[model samples]
Target: MSSIIKELVSDPHSSEIISLAVGMPDPFLYPLDVFQRILENMPATNPSDFGYIATEGYLPLRRTIAHMLSSNGIETTPERTLILSGAQLLVLPTEAGLNLEILEDYLIRYRPKLFYTVSTYNNPTGQVLTEQERRELLLLARRHRLVIVEDDPYSQLYYEEKPPLPIKSMDSFEGVVYIGTFSKTLIPGLRVGFLTGHSALIHRLALEKQYVDLHSNNFSQWLINFYLEQGYFEDHLNFIRSEYKKRRDSLVKAIRRYLENNVHFNVPGGGFYLWCKLKGTITSGRLLQEATKCGVFFVPGQAFNARPTEENEFRLCFASQPEPVLVEGVKRLAKALEILQKSKTPRKISESFLKPIV
Candidate 1:
């Protein structure tokens, strides 16, 4: 959430940080003019409408999201959908997808109350759970009587074929709590997200949420619902999808051209990150030190793991920067890697440069 990268880049703050660290959308792409128009022309509301509303968020917004989810195959009613932004559990992934055997093993041993995951274009790693995996996972959860928190913020940003229907879309057990956010899909500033699950569970969660903000921002919820209803979101999604794919491609090309075999990375089909492994003996911390000197920064993979066994991994986000900037960051990252390889003594980042994140 330290939006230091885009904020500093646009305004040219004194901070010398050129961050590829954060996993947020570029501010430049927000449809500000359209937002202003939506506001200026918004219909008036009652005085109470601006005050405390339902803790589950604006009713219209919930219904709107319900319809959207149903159309996408995750049949849910407004009663089962709650508006909010949210996160949990770490699962080590494989090239094929999530390691189902490991998760089942963990479940059988621990019988954990909740299992959380990103079944599509997962953050940091960009791995996805195949349809088979999703179905099998649902069965496992059902057998264990365990609940799943499926965080799916990046599915809409796919560059390849649309990923398999969300696990929630196929949750016959009604145990998958599907979470989505407009923060990535529509507007970040709004900070609006939605969760759909069992109606009883949603009510319990909503009751707990009541003490937090009393309710989500009424205005933002109303606006987003209108945005969806007027069909503004589809066009916006198409625009971002095209642009982010270009940035992803640019970052991939830059990494290969500069870093080459010094590092190993997975080229994600979508999502914002390029999860990389340091091929040499250098740890991510040492490389970050060199990278910082080069005016680039990334979150080390260790930060994402609770029980990190190695320090050779790191994450780079591609959605936060423009194509040229992504390439430039990668170039700087390559320089840092080079500096790390060549010198034990701390050295300056040569004037030349170039980097991504989850």
Candidate 2:
């Protein structure tokens, strides 16, 4: 689990603590109506609903996902989509803005078989790769015989214009594997996510999964199938987009009002995080300590760095909290910064400590 998520889950509701740590979706947006409808329509007691599905996942859901990917410009068949349970690992190019020059050099030196990225509205940074960068990555992957894994779970949560098309949508998508999820769209409890790629690869993955969990929950799959088929997913997406945008705006406003001079950050066009760089000497670790004292919590930015870390950066998430709570959290963060700034005193050099150099 991510350090941010661990912090959120452990002691989630302390008396006065306001957490802007995790990217968890707002529980207030749960689509009770759609799930209620699906439950009402489901047979009261059906053995098939409890039976094990194919290792690849329920066929209907796979088919739905295939069609959805096709619309997104990733031409795939149901046989090509591998439904997975989770994902992990981290390493990235050194150059900022996802520099392809560094990426190609790393690819050549490492000769890695697979490359992975969050391409759209990246976690923590909220930076979306430009189309030109995506194209360059695809070309490099093809030239070097490397597989690209695109984990995109936030594409649908944009507050501004939609982000660039997925790399899997490119004509060179044959070497690209795309992963997406309904966990954010519906609810995380649903545990529904899928991977799209060549049928041959999907087949092998399914074979491996069969030995693991047998299959994902069949009952949940049926509910998702019903939700998608009945067109509830689209309505739900629209609803949350509006609500989350409000929360994003609220956090941004509060940060500007309270921490603007002390910190610097770009407003995200979409997704759950606000990455902030401190303008002072306060390290994120120290800030987190003081913020905890001020009744707020956020992850230090060093947690996300692939190399040696500067201590001045941290991430704040606006999606999990209500608008009022989001604002309060920022105020608490500001309070923490003020406290830290005031508490620091410059060390004075004593004449007794200074020895004359001969």
The models' CA-based lDDT, in order, is 0.78, 0.76
Q: Which ten residues in a row have the lowest lDDT in candidate 2?
A: 349-358
Give the TM-score of each candidate. Answer: 0.86, 0.85
- Model 1 per-residue lDDT tens digits across residues 253-327: 999999889889878988888889989888886787777779887777777776745778888888878887778
Where does model 1 exceed 4 Å of error? 1-16, 86-112, 345-358
How well is each residue in 32-79 modelled by candidate 2, as lDDT tens digits? 876886787874545675687788888888888888887788888888
Top model number, lDDT? 1
Report the C-alpha displacement of residue 79, candidate 1, in angstroms: 0.7
